[model samples]
Target chain A: MWDFIVERRSQLLINGFNHVYLVFLAVVFATIIAVAIAILVTRLPKLEPVANAVSAIGLTIPSFALIGLLIPVSKIGDGTAIIAVTFYAVLPILRNAVVGLQGVSPTLLESAKGMGMSEFTSLYKVRIPMAWPVILAGIRVSTQMSMGIAAIAAYVLGPGLGTFIFTGLTGYGGANAFNNVFVATVAIIVLALILDLLLIILGRLTISKGIRVA
Target chain B: MADVATAPNAQADARERTGRKRGPKLDAEQLIELFGIPLIVVVGFVAFAIWRNTATLDSVETNALPWNSIWIQLREHVVLTAVGAMITVVIAVPLGIALTRPGLKRAAPVVVGVANAGQAAPAIGLIVLLAIWFGFGFWTAIVALVLYAVLPVLRNTIVGLQAVDPTLVEAGRGIGMSNLMVLRRIELPLALPVIMSGVRTALVLLVGTAALATFINGGGLGGLLNTGITLFRFPVIVAAAVLIALLALLIEWLGQVLELVFRPKGI
Candidate 1:
């Protein structure tokens, strides 16, 4: 593995960058949509269950199937891949965001209002800030999920390290098959770990000191 | 004439009372979900079936459409999911229960952290990694699925066992029941719902991940997906996706029914 990485340093770096880029786009798309929907449903209350159920069903569809379904509409490329990954990312982040928003104490909201803060201001300043940790946790979940699913995006010709795995599998007994797949696998795992650690740091730095749990 | 006036007031009062009682409850929406999911599967499958019967794809080089090859892949998918779920339940449940015990308490965070890492990592990476190690087949797929699905079951099991009413366990012990006896008689029963939810989550996860098995020639509905994608056959790809979604929803429905069966009586 070390030898393979050394030999293919430039190629690996490009694939690694693609993997991160694909995941980054998908996560950002999912977080925006999920957070928006979560906030909307939280206010509506009655729609919360509907939103949850839909996301649950969305979550059940395999990454392979989703990419396949999107192929016709989006055509085989990064477009289809990003859309599928975004679909998968939406569920966890949406669920977590909803939970986080709902978890905010009612008394806290009341207190914000007592201070004469506008509803929107209180939501922005008090509610969302308090809900940030759980929402971040959701984004972290979405990031990890999208990283894996992004590999499947290779089916649609989406850029990622998954190209190596698929190519290795398709070329089974050929030379360098094992090395290609192995390196890609290692790269993906490393990426997942690094991303997770980044999120952990982001969580710590963003969350206020008084509210920080050990 | 007087009855008309009184009737209008009565109707208004009843409407106000019911509206107040309903408040923000989403009972109607929940009912729709209860009924709507199955309705979707039925409608979607019926539509797909019609398309399969009428829609001809001369560009297709693969086997007949989705249904013709579906049974083969469906069997593989179901068996793979079942075996994976069984392994997850067998391992995760016990470990989850054990972690709640006195001796293993300190190991909980470490075990959970490792499990979290497993879940957080890309699933395809894990599946392919295992395929390389085990030489690509059904068992390899099962192992991969098991590893991916275990976390939810394990996490839920721990949470479930820990959340069980402590008083019930203490009462069981006070009656001279052994620790194992208390766990079995009191704790497990109370934790059953949570454990079941975990199992359901794992099953749904396994069902989804099992699709990736086709990447390693493990053979499932994903074969259709991969072939359809490769050939750019629109009908085949969409039909396969619809079927896979239906299968997942049906399994989740089955899990819900199983939950009802396992649920303790009298609250």
Candidate 2:
């Protein structure tokens, strides 16, 4: 294992970086899209159940299946991988964002209206800010989930350390096979922990003092 | 309805949520979920069937598209999910109950913390590592699936049991119910909803992860996908993916049904 590390030190670093980068990129896009759709659902209200049901169904589809399903259309590349990661990433966040935005107390919104705040202003100044904590929670979940899904997406030639796992699988009986998969697995676990810690810190720095859980 | 004039949407949202918690008693939203999932699966399978029956296939596609092999793979996948979930429940629920008991109460969070950390490992990585260690096969996949799924059930079981009202347990004891009786008759029923929800989640997780079992020669619809991808056969890949997705949906639907059926009557 030590020699294996020495042999592929730079390649390991690049794969690890790519893994984080892919998940991070997909998560950012998912958060934005989910939040926007959540806002719309909240505004319509009738769309709530539909949105919930859609998310439930969406989340049910396995990442493996989704990656395969997309291959025909997206043709087995980073596009398919990113799309699949973003697809899964969106659901938990969308559900949370919907709940978060709707969780803004009705009285508070009315108060914002009484203060001469416009609809947009109230949503911007009150609704979203108030919902930030829950949305951030969703983002955290999405980020973590995306990390795993992105690993699987590597089967489709997606950028990531998952290549090591697949590579290890291909050479199953070889001396370095276990170490290869082991390194990717450990690297992914470490990355996931680091990202989760970062999200917690982000929540700390961003959550309003008034609503801080302590 | 009267309050709707004042707070139409939130009132509806609250009612919707409450209706869901109240369980599948003909509520519109619940009914939609109850029926909508199966409807999607039915339609998906129909499409898959039509394509499978009619599509012109190359020699590679023809070789991969046999019904016998597909059925075998499907059976393997379902068995992996079902058995893995059953074992997970057996182990996780009992352990969870033990943890919440007085003797093991303090260990609950520590166990949950460790399980949560274990979850950070990617599913594919875990499966591959385990396969390498255990050697590739169905049992290896089952073990991987069990490890991946146990945390949710365990966590939910502890949380659910802890949430049971202590006074109710005391009441049972006050009436000469033994500790075990209080647990069986009072606590488990009250906690069933939460625990069952966790079980449902674990079931779904098992379905998803079981697809990865094909990597270790565990034999599932993923074999079709592996064949398709490696052979560059589009039909095979799509069929495999869709079938796997459909199976997952069906399992999710079955889980919801079980959760409703096993729910203690009064609660």
Candidate 3:
């Protein structure tokens, strides 16, 4: 294992970075889209159930199935992977953002209005800030989920450490098969932890002191 | 992670604890799921059947896209999911109970924290590694699936039991009930909803993971996917994808119904 690591250190680092980068970009895009849709759901209460149903049904669909469906239209490679990862990434954050924004007290909105804030301003300043921690929690979950989804998306020739696992499988009887699988799996786990810790730090920096939870 | 299904249970808990104005609202959400899922399943099945009948298949597609083979794959997927889930519940719930007991209670957080960290590892990576270690087959796939799913059930079991009102447990003991009696009569019933919700989440996770079983020759609808992609058969690919999605949706709906039907009322 040590020899394997020494020989493939740069290759391992590149794959690991691509995996993290892939998930990170998808999660960021997902957070934005989900939060915006969540804001819409908050504004139009009727859209709430529709949003809920979509997210609930959405999460249940297998990533493998989605990848299969995507191939004819999207062809193979990073686009399919990104689209699939972002799709799964959206559901958790969407659910969380809706919950987070709704959990923001109506009274706070009323007070913001009383202070002469517009609806947009109230959302921008008061509601979103109050909801930031919960949304961030959603982002963390989204990031974790996206990590797994991106790995699966790699089956489509997508960029990631997931390629190593598949390679390890195809070379099942080879001497380095276990090493390949073990190294990629461990690297993905480590990256997920680092991302989660980073999200916690983000929470510390972004969340309002008054609303922040220990 | 909430895994989507747990969100409703959390809502239910909030409603129970806070007496929130959420009544009838969730009924509508449930109604959408209840009515909508089966409809989509039927539609997808019909559409796929029509497409399968109408579409011209090449020799490779003809061999790979038979109805009997599809049924077998579907059965394999379900069996893999169901067996894996049953094993997970059997292992996770009891272990959860043991961990929450007085002597082992301190280990709860330690276990959950470890499991949470472990969950971040990709499912395919785990499956591949396990296959390499144990040799690929149905049981290896099942083991990987169980390991992947056990965390949600275990965490939920612990959380559900812990969330039970202590005063109620004391009240049962105060009335001269034995520890086992109190657990059966008081704690388990109250925690049933939360626990079932977790199981539902696990069930959904299992179904999704089982689709990947084809990778290891464990047999499932994923073979259609694997075959399609390698063969570049678009018809087989679309049918497999649709069927898998429909099956997952149907299972998810069943899980929600199970949560409603099995959760003891009068909580």
What ranges in model 2 sit over 4 Å off? B1-28
lDDT of each residue in B1-267, candidate 3, tens digit only: 233211111111111111112232355666788899999999988988988888888888889889899999999999999899899999999998888899999999899888877787788999999999899899999999998888878887898899999999999999999999998899889888878877888888889999989888888889888988888888778888999999999888888888778767685
CA RMSD per model (angstroms): 10.4, 5.6, 3.6
- When just chain B is superposed on the true chain B, each candidate scores a TM-score of 0.85, 0.90, 0.90
In model 1, how large is the Cα lDDT of residue A207?
Answer: 87
Residue-level lDDT of model 2, residues B4-73, one tens digit each, is 1111101011111111235535455456778998999999989888888898988789899998998999
lDDT by residue for model 1 over B65-170, one digit each (tens)? 7465788888988988888888989999988988999999899979877776556556676777777778888888888888777777787688778888888888
Tens digit per residue, CA lDDT, model 1, A1-214: 6787799899889989999998888888988998899899878987876776676667667778778778889988889988988887777778667767877899999999999999899888887888787777777767766777888788678999999887877777777778887888778877877887788888889986767777
Candidate 2 docking quality: incorrect, acceptable, medium or high: acceptable
Least accurate stretch of 10 residues (summed lDDT) in model 2 chain B? B3-12
Tell me what TM-score chain A of model 1 achieves: 0.96
Instruction: Tell me the TM-score of model 1.
Output: 0.88
Lowest summed lDDT across 10 adjacent residues in model 1 chain B is found at: B3-12
